[model samples]
Target chain A: MNMVVCIKQVPDSAQIRVHPVTNTIMRQGVPTIINPYDLHALEAAMALRDRLGGTVTVLTMGPPMAATALRKALGHGADRGILLSDRFFAGADTLATSYALTSAIQKIGESRPVDIVFTGKQTIDGDTAQVGPGIARRMGLNQLTYVSAIPTIDQEAGEITVHRRAEGGVQVLKTKLPCLITMLEATNVLRRGSLPDMLRAERAEVETWNAEAAGVEDIGKCGMKGSPTKVSKVFAPSPRAEKAKMVEGDTAEAKARVAIDALAETDPQLLSVIARQPALAS
Target chain B: KSKELPEHLKAYKNVWVFVELEHGRVHPVSWELLTEGRKLAAALNVDLAGVVLGPSGEGTDSAVAEAFHYGADRVYLVEDPLLENYRTDPFTKAMTDLVNTHKPEVLLLGASTLGRDLAGAVATTLATGLTADCTELAIDPNRNMAATRPTFGGSLLCTIMTQQARPQMATVRPRVMAMGEPDRSRSGEVVRERLDMVEEDIVTKVLDFIPDADSNQAQLAFADIVVAGGLGLQKPENIKLVKDLAAVLGAEYGCSRPLIQKGWMTADRQIGQTGKTIRPRLYIAAGISGAIQHRVGSEGADQILAINIDPNAPIFDFAHHGIVGDALEILPALTEAFRQRLAVDRLAG
Candidate 1:
């Protein structure tokens, strides 16, 4: 029943802005937090552990400062935190990231077998949602993604049933144990840490693993070398030239009337279409 | 300039688009990819093909025929009952098997829920690189595909290339590409492949599918008119104003990502890059600031009317019409105005 939750530290996107004149990213002074979607994954893992009486291990691959994110996870009820950090692991894309994380998970499984692996559906910064499936494929585990709910888990039978979000509907899927799951966001509320959990979080030592210690067999596959995808250029989106034709009025009511008139005038059929829907007109 | 094609990947040829068919309906994004894939295939001097995997039925056959109509020179078909429900195991295996058997130089898929899930697994199984949610796709001098997508929270765009990977893969979000007009006279060869795996080998089973009830879900993608609210609405209750306006016009109502993240609206009602790409005839965005992510989704609207208190809001830059006032106040007024206008027209008619 042991679960491993992978989280990442990302810059608070709300605070991230582009320079007006230079059009360069203004990243300075922004604080880093565990990816918002990962919080839902962490909460899902903790809930399962709380109900099943097992351990939840928080894992992350980032710089040394990323230990803070792991500590935050510990405070939020993760039993242990592991940080996979090394200079060789820098500039890794989702492929290389999954390689390093999968190796670290294998090393963790050497002590206690991992029954399930949890990750967010996608990171706000990367937004790829590829790494989790990459790890699952490499590790030969079932990949369950966009999971909205875990309604039942049968440890004895080695099965888990989940509600997955599809294009037009929800799919109730049942899979075997040892599956990797990427949780959809806002499925459950994150729980607050108790006094004892915070105290323990402060005292707990975060395990830091280098590439070799994490059993990375190939150094070339650990970072940029292993990444097949390369970014050729980064640029800001070009803005459109046409500005909105603003409707002026002293009051909101007048403005509304002007806007409606403008829309109807611009597209004469709009009024007729609205009137045609009798249920809407009344 | 682009790096030379690696010696091992030199044999890879043709461009393939995964034709996503479910419940006997082909997802529009699949056809859109075929349109774009035709250009890429022409640029590379290779054939454009469509890959259809579904149960043995008329659905799969029609998909193959439609692929030809939409500019595909050939169609790859793998029909099996196991491929029906889109389990990750069977779909990934089928796709990876196809790629290994018939090496495609470039593969395109829709950035839908099913496509994203399947692409990730298939790419990983094949140990190839994949670019997700690509906004642009092109072939360079070296014949390598360049996939450009939004990065860093849509504040910037990054062009990614899978330089060393064979069968370079990318997923384009729906509505990002133009759908090609189907030519009924067009025809193509269908190559049928068999999925070796059986039902027992696939660990995951689709226990049930609960289709979204008509009343409970917002059909934003096909709506002719849409009214969306944002954080500028100030409170959850203010959303009633947006619903009222939409009701008057017989339009769908949606909201920006923040409202969905804040639990004020359902995910289906979210209009943005990560949510839904809507191409409504008229879109009224109240209180939205038009971030690049949101713009990518709603820019296809024929007319965009932005309402916000800030004249400097980014939404104004792209909106066809705008009003500088609080949406909280203006939305109710607009609702009343539209209601009266429609009522008078109804009476006259």
Candidate 2:
């Protein structure tokens, strides 16, 4: 199996802060981490490589600095890393993003017949879980999204069975190989690479591909120009003016009472809730 | 190659919200979108319509009738059992057919699991742009549907526009928009549409739906009050403090997406981007370093109280009130405080 995992570099949301006067995120100095969700996807791919006897390649489309994420993927047991960086790829939405990625995958496929493509369920920055599906649609890869478990793999039969997170339920689906999968969080635990893996990753030369090198023919379809959607503005939501009625009391029991009383007046439906559920009262 | 619409095709107007039904029950998110769509429709000075696709029969009629009561001026109904199980192939075909036949300026769907799935497929089929999980939607002065949603994982808000697209599309998370009162006497014109595609063409089959276990499911969407903790809780065991606080406040307990990602909290109890959208009376965010993704999910809360040791936390920007304190210390304090206050109030009453 020639497995490919896509990763993204994002600002650590924990340390991300907004300027008081500007009301915009102070992104300049904040450190970036390989998106936590993508780490799970990379880990899953590496595990499959180790178990099935295959090579794992990590791919990313971002600024040149995103090579750091590729290095991190290499450090975590990936065999090779490719960075698709170009000025034309900036400000691409999910559709345009999928185009660039699909074109790059096609380029990579020229060298190796790709068996599986892995992506996080969604990126923290994009938050739209559409790219995985978008890429699958473009590449005609069988998309298995929100996948919780890769229960079994029939290598000889060229098929894989997975547990998917559907609405209000789970769906167990079996599909053929050469598919795109977006792994749900916590599906598999990421493994720590040995000292040799870390040392090799630090010294490994990552291959870079520009749009032309990635087989992107129409530059218009690779970035913001190809994206039909445009973000017009972003602003802080209007703050609520009313203050919370701070309730004070001595004992935990008494405090519960005050809070419940406020709940009764503010959200009166809660009073009936307390009346109905005795477990809540005590 | 002119992709521009002919003058005749450009006459289509108004905004439409697809009233989604599953297993014979109308999803509550439909009503929420109706309330939101009504506002957008009024602002755009166009009729607010609903497109209902289900098995042709009593249930379909009732769903369309309910749409009128919820402020839709008209309801487009397509009755077919093939539409029964919310299949992507049939639903997408039905919706796109409606859009092609009677074009709407803006289309809205609830950002539920079903809505997200259907919206993406349908939008792609139509080759139209779609903004998913929009926290806010409004008509710009140009009458374009301006969809404001969180971007960069909810660290920032991005207003997206689908230029040159006839039907601007967006999906809103459930509970983020308020549902208006149902005026049962309200009436609307209902048009029955036909499905030309047969069931055989649909490739994917729904073998079965294993319902979520009761223990694993959290009714966070409809919970009136939510108490959620973030990394500030310090240890996984400290999550008990969140449950205790929620108990005193009569609120459901959840956590930021990280806690869920970290396996510190159940998937259902995660409250942020990719988790659940909650619009509670009060949302007490403790130790949560509100990322744009998390903030977008909870920004709809009527009252947001943020408690964090670092006053510089982004959660404070949208929080109704901010307490510069340690969550581990303040949580116990607040829990104890609420517990006592509630007891005295009950005694006084």
Q: Top lDDT: which candidate number?
A: 1
Clashing pairs in 1: none
lDDT (C-alpha, whole model) for all candidates = 0.89, 0.79
The candidate scoring highest on DockQ is 1
Backbone clashes in candidate 1 total 0
The CAPRI classification for model 2 reads as acceptable
lDDT of 1 by residue, B1-349 (tens): 4467778788889999999999888999999999999999999988999999999888888888999999999999999999888888888888888999999989999988899998888887777789989989999887889999987767777789998888899998887787879999999889889999988899999999988766656778877888999999989998999988888888989999999979998878888877888887789999999987788789888889999889999999889999999898898999898888777877887
Q: After TM-score superposition, what is the CA distance of residue B306 in candidate 2 from its true location, in Å?
A: 6.3
Q: Which stretches of candidate 2 lie over 4 Å from their true place?
A: A14-26, A53-55, A110-113, A155-157, A194-196, A236-282, B1-12, B54-62, B192-200, B228-250, B256-264, B284-296, B304-349
DockQ of 1: 0.63
Residue A27 shift from truth in candidate 2, angstroms: 3.1
lDDT of 2 at B170: 90
| Per-residue C-alpha lDDT of model 2 across residues A90-111, encoded as one tens digit per residue | 9888778888999998888898
lDDT: worst 10-residue window of model 2 chain B? B1-10
The positional error of residue B148 in candidate 2, measured at the CA in angstroms, is: 1.3
DockQ of 2: 0.30
> What is the C-alpha interface RMSD of model 1?
2.6
What candidate 1 gets wrong by more than 4 Å, as runs, is: A14-26, A249-282, B214-216, B235-237, B261-264, B291-293, B332-349
Cα lDDT of model 2 by residue, B245-287, tens digit: 8877667889997788688987888887667888876788888
TM-score of model number 1, chain B: 0.90
